[model samples]
Target: MNRDKDIYVLLTDTGTVLTKIIRTFTKDPLNHASIAFDEDLNEVYSFGRKNPSNPFFAGFVRENVRGEFFEESMCALYRCKVSQSAYSGIRAQIQHFEQYSDLYKYNLAGMLGVVLNIEWEREYAYFCSQFVATIFKRSGVSLVDKSPLLVTPGDFQTTPHLELIYHGKLHDYTGCEVTAAAAGGSFRTA
Candidate 1:
């Protein structure tokens, strides 16, 4: 039997200048995307600012959900189930990226291509959503029927593959609590 495990998709609106610019184009409240390996989000990854204060110096990052950048961010969390082998594949892919992170860069140009409805794929470079979609695709999982280069944070919301688990302030998220509530226990939302 193939046991299943869950991977988390986190979308957020950090209210930064870059996010505001992205929000203007996408018209989506949440302009950034991340992947979390755990229900409590101890391991969250994204292609974003390397320094919290400098959006220009950006690339692969292991996000701290409790960081000042996310303290007041609005967010939506989704869960996707995958077979054990697929989970292992995803983990291996993340590890590969982590080991060679120096070779990667944030795909700012690709974000422009997204606005123009064009696909711009660069070697070792990815935007936030593109990175997440690429991870799933490379791991033999399809989150949506589209090219990873064309994937946007908003695409995740409309994809049938992901189950919406929580939507609120990132600071207010109690992952295990939310998980229990989603499993039919009572949950209080702020």
Candidate 2:
């Protein structure tokens, strides 16, 4: 696959926001910058400046900016952070790459594949959840079912930091029964 076609998936609680920011950085030629809401009016954020000595900043800019004029030697340093994050043994990979130039090519090919797969999975899950919710809505059924999909104690792997109580059942079983019947499913009752 072409390097430009490769995707990077960031998996975290704020994945959506992170993905948007990354896209903005990659899609633009100018140094993308934004002011923090909490910061004073005098201060401004400046990203993407070419600096050879500072490996960290150089790497960060190269990853964010595509088709920009970056030195060939700095490409290894630019990919170092990604290599370290995706694999446990970066030192070994670097050493191997040094001994065999062909290894670097293989390493990049594998890493790009992993990144694209992760992005696709995240996108698929998000769309699937949306589709499920839409089906429930169209069937006149609430998506938030009350009969906990999870049980207590076994589900309580962590201590209760917060708690909420519903005055009534979140889902209507009667509506579900009608929908299920139409959809060719039988709900067993005791």
Clash number for every model? 0, 0
Q: What TM-score fits each model? A: 0.90, 0.17
Give the C-alpha lDDT of model 1. 0.87
lDDT by residue for model 1 (75-161), tens: 888889998888999999899989999999999999999999899989889999999999999888999788999888999999998
Name the top TM-score candidate: 1
Global lDDT of each candidate = 0.87, 0.22
Minimal lDDT window, size 10, model 1: 181-190
Q: What TM-score does candidate 2 get on C-alpha atoms?
A: 0.17
